[model samples]
Target: MRASLVPGVALLGSYPAKSLPRDLVAGLVLTALLVPQGMAYAELAGLPAITGLYTSILCLLGYAFFGPSRILVLGPDSSLGPMIAATVLPLVAADGDPRRAVALGSALALMTGAMALLAGIGKLGFIADLISKPTMIGYMNGLALTILVGQLPKLFGFSVDASGLFAELIGFAAEVAGGATVPAALAIGLGGLVVILALQRVLPKIPAVLVVVVLSIGAAAVLGLGDRGVDLVGPLPQGFPPLTIPYITLSDVPLLLAGALGITVVSLADTISTATAFAARTGQRVDGNKEMIGIGAANVAAGLFQGFPVSTSGSRTAVAEQAGARTQVTGLVGAGAISLILLLAPGLLRNLPQPTLAAVVIAASLSLADIPGTVRLYRLRRTEFSLSIAAFVGVVWLGVLPGIAVAVALSIGNVFRRAWWPYQTVLGRVPGIPGYHDVRSYPHAERLPGCPIYRFDAPVFFANARTFREQILALAESQPRPAWIIVAAEPITDVDTTAADMLRDLDLDLELNKKGVDIVFAEMKDPVRRKIDQYELTATIDPAHFYPTLDAAITAFRTTAGAEWGPAPAEEAS
Candidate 1:
């Protein structure tokens, strides 16, 4: 049980000594990227820049101890920043107290961690699939837009006292219109963005974030930009925060819980997808439940250490892997390196320009938006495209947490819609085809006269039983109806009590009204046949009316009723 719960423990026991050097090298490479991105994502989350580093350090250490993946990197994520801010900023409100903000942020992480832990323990990792692909794409695109808009003010060298996407947009415009833009800050910000994007485009292996950050800091110190209207990160706290429980007032629990739920869904989906991608490359098996446990531990650790929630970083994981990371030891080494920085060189990033942080976040947001995926959805499926648009609108208009709720609701609604109105068709024998096929697909196919073979695609349940009964009744009342009405029962995987009862009533009604034109089931599964017996449906539907195969049903029908095959009449099209 312990091994299952903490697979990283098992990994440690089998840890090879030679792999240590590779991990050490990879860890150093990852640190160069982690430091700048962490601070940037922290700012994106509306927390101090230092908390990002705090989060980066602890989440790595925590996942190293419990994570199942050999080398998946976990840290503050750009996609999660707006969500964390949406949760924490409201409670902080007009006061904007840093301590209260940190407390709320940490507590949010705790709530998120607890929920994930419970889900992992319950083996409910399949909950991640609750959000469908199109919804996820739309939700992420909205998030990318939100992040881009939210960071614009900081990038332009000013502050916006606005909440939500539209308000922030309006505020940013007003700030720009009011001549509040600092030329030096904007220049540095735009310069950093250019350098980062160019380097990443031309030199994929180079650490663009680290490069931009180091050069920006050097420029800031040499040019005295901080003294000339530009804001600096100043200095982070001297050392790591002691472990302390995150706290918020009782009144805040409900809101925090709502946010945590959304966070948990997004985190699980992101982690699983990222893990699967990397696992495929490394030939590693991904255990979703174990992943949840690892993520839970990571969030719990961050929450206890003055940090906030986090998720897997695909870019960072790729960088680590490309740098020769062989196991979680790479994460531990990175954590240790950051710890040393906090202890010995806390002021190392003091001159890092704040605009460069915005540049980092903006770049990440660009990656999050999936225009090609959205376009593909539009080209392939209109219903799903509509769903994608709805999810996107929900996120942009209703905020991140509410947007996630909308996305989940749309996913479930889409599933129910399909089940409630499944792709039903009438089957007929084609000239050359062996088995019966959909008449809609093979028009002019010969159908047995006076006996229509209907196929209902979905499993019969209480909700769709009425539709089933009505359709069967419609088939019975059709022109020139006679003898047994054949049903292609192969697709009916399940039959509930309501459907069974309805079948019994329908069979009786056919006998009374349609003059012995009873229902004949073909290719019914054995389990469903037993269920029919269990419901005592044989008392109404003839025991002989059920057939093990469609050919058997056809043979029995021909032997009993002498029906001849002929082209479906124009009136039979319905």
Candidate 2:
């Protein structure tokens, strides 16, 4: 039996002494990346910069204890920032109190964490599968554009009163046209961007964001940019994150529930994808349910510490892995470093330009765009590419939270659409081939004289029962009408009640037809066969008609249809 619920505790007994020094150094290095990113993502989420620090500390500590992956880093993520803002923005008071905004964000984290915990406990990790890869590509692309546009005002040292992505873009354009941007802030922002981009190209292994941040701060202090009408992050409150309980009324539960569920979905999806990717590189197994538990624990901790919803950071995890992190100790050490900063150097970034932070966020958002992946999707599958584009439009036009719903709906709809009009083909024996193949792909292949094999590539469910019945009948109506029709049931992993009823009706209809055609199943799995038996379908269609394989079905058909049917095509040819 396990000694504790925390996975990290179990691993501590066997922890290698050789890895400890490397883990410590990696942790310190990771703190350099985490500080600026935490603050930037907090601002991105429409919360105070310091809360980002609080979030980062608590979430890291939480994941270090509960998370299964050794190097996985959990923190406020760029992709999830706009989503957090979208969720809590509507509930903020018209006057906008930072305290209220923080409370709302914390509440969202709590709700999101609770939902994730329930999902993990229920072993519903498959919920993450709802968002297909194409949908995710589009969603992230749209979110990137949204974050980029939203950050432009900060980078330009201006503020825009805009509600959506289009309005923000228009507002930004108008502001630029009116010369409303501060030149000093723009200079700092542009300079930071240049340094970041340059370092990324010339010295990719270095912490470019950290270097740019320190340089930008030095320049700001030396040039007294704050005195020149430039906005700064100002002094942050010192010491550790205070314990917080989100104060929300019962009336707020419904909206918060919707937002929490949306955040939960995106958070789990992001976490699982990142964990799985890094696990592949390290040759480790990822337990999705355990991941959900870890992520949920992190969120819950963040919420209790006055922070917002967060997810796995792929970039940070890579940094830790590259920095030679060997265990969750790296994350714990990183969290400790942030805690020390909060305690001892809280005001170290007081003169840091907000525009530079905006630049950091913009760079992170740009990384999330995944342009190459989208292009590859387009080249590989046009229809799926179109679906991705549609998801993008939904996010850009409908807003972030609603766009999640749209993406999920599109993914599910795509599944049903494919099933409703699933690909089906007639099978024939090609001269040089073994078993059977699609006749359409091998036009020269000959069909069995009085038997036609048809294959439907999706499960037989209510959604496609009618189509299945119609298509099979149409195949029977062909010039060389089959006396016995065999279904290639290998792909039909499931058989719902509606489909079973349809099958029964079709059997009766075929019996009444003067052509005397019979329908049989080939290569059906035992579970589906059991379902058929439960449905009492054998009363109308004989149980003996079910064959374990296509070859067995063909042999039965040959024996029944007579020698004139020709020794089973392969045997005759041999």
Candidate 3:
């Protein structure tokens, strides 16, 4: 039970001796990326740069203690940064007190963490399926564009008072036209971008961001770039993050709840997806509920340490895996390294150029765009592609929080839309084939002389109940009217009350038909048959009409009608 609750204990118990060096090295390498990213994402969340470090430290430590994924690195993420800013910025006083912003941010994180924890405990991990793959692609693409546009002003060494993506883009353009951007900052930012890109192409294994950061800092310090109108991150405070509880009035909690729920959904979705992907590669399985708990713990720790929410970092996790991470010990070492930096050299990044940080963030955002995947989706499924496009537009035009709602709604709506008008077809037997296939797909196939086999691909639920009845009745009206309507019930796994009523009505309607058509269900699952009995459908329709297989139903039909039937299809015997 304890091992189930604290996965780290089990990981440590089986920790290999030879893996220690690799884990340590991976941890140190991860620190190189985490330090810069933590600060960049922190600023993106509208918090002080130092808080990013705090978030990284606590999240890494917390995840190490509770997370199930051995190599997934938890830290401040670019996607959630805008979400945090959106949720907390409005609540800050007009004067924009930094302390109040921190408190609000902490409260948001705490609330999100608590919600996620409750969801995990409730075993509601299936909720992650709310966002389909297409929706995810759209959401990430929109988020990438949003983050890119939001960072443009910083990249140009200017600030804009814009509210959203379009307004921000307009503000950025106007600033450029007005010559508000500083040349030195632009040079540094562009130089940083070029160096990172070139190194990534030439030597993909190199830590390009870290190298660029060091060079940029060195150049800024030696060339006195700060004096030439370049903005710097300034000095960060030394020592560990102070622990504090987020204080908010009851009134504030209600306002923050909506935002917290949004954050929890987005964060958990990303976490579970990343964990599942990495676990597949490593030949391991991840528990979604346990992952929720781990992520919740990380967020809770971050909130208590004057930090905002965090998520699993795919890039960081990749780096750790490549660096030979063997267990959660890698996260522990990474957290320890960051803590030591805070304790010993917190001001080391004081000369880091702000434009360069913006450049780093922009590069990270670039990774979020999935153009190739989106294009593939378009080529394969046009409707899904359109849904993806809608999700992207929703995020870009409506804002991140509202975009989440739109994306989720579109995902769920797409599911119901498919089920509501499910693909159903009449079945026929091919010349020498076994069983039955869709008549539309096998036009030359022959239909039974006085029976029509029908197949509905989805469950009979409230939404599709009427459609099921209509389609069945339409098939019954076709020429060579079926004396016995054999339903291919293999695909119909469920039958709701509404569907049961619809089925009863259909049975009564068939009974009244002058041709004397009868309905029979073939290959019906036991559970569905039991549901019919529960609905008192057995009293209305003959219980003997339920056949275990299509062949059995056909045999029974032959016996009832005293009609000679053709031999079974070749594939049936095989």
Q: Which residue runs does candidate 3 get wrong by more than 4 Å?
A: 510-512, 562-574
After superposition, which runs of candidate 2 have C-alpha atoms over 4 Å from their true positions?
1-4, 510-512, 563-574
- Ten contiguous residues minimizing lDDT sum, candidate 1: 510-519
- Tens digit of per-residue lDDT, candidate 1, span 1-574: 5776777778888899999999999999999999999999988988988999999999998899888899999999988898899888888958788888899999998888888888888999998888999999999999999999998998999999888899999999999999999999999999999999999899989999999999999999999999889999998899889988876789999989999999999998899889999999868889898899889999999999999999999999999999999999999999999999999999999999999999999999999999999999999999999999999999999999899999999999999988888888778989887889998888778888778889999899888898888888778777677567788899999999999989988888834354667788988999988999999999988898888888998888888778889887876554
Question: Order of all candidates by lDDT, from best down to worst?
Answer: 1, 2, 3
Report, for every candidate in turn, its global Cα lDDT versus the true structure. 0.91, 0.90, 0.89
Give lDDT for model 1: 0.91
The estimated TM-scores of all candidates read: 0.97, 0.96, 0.96
Candidate 2's TM-score: 0.96
Worst 10 residues of 3 by lDDT: 565-574
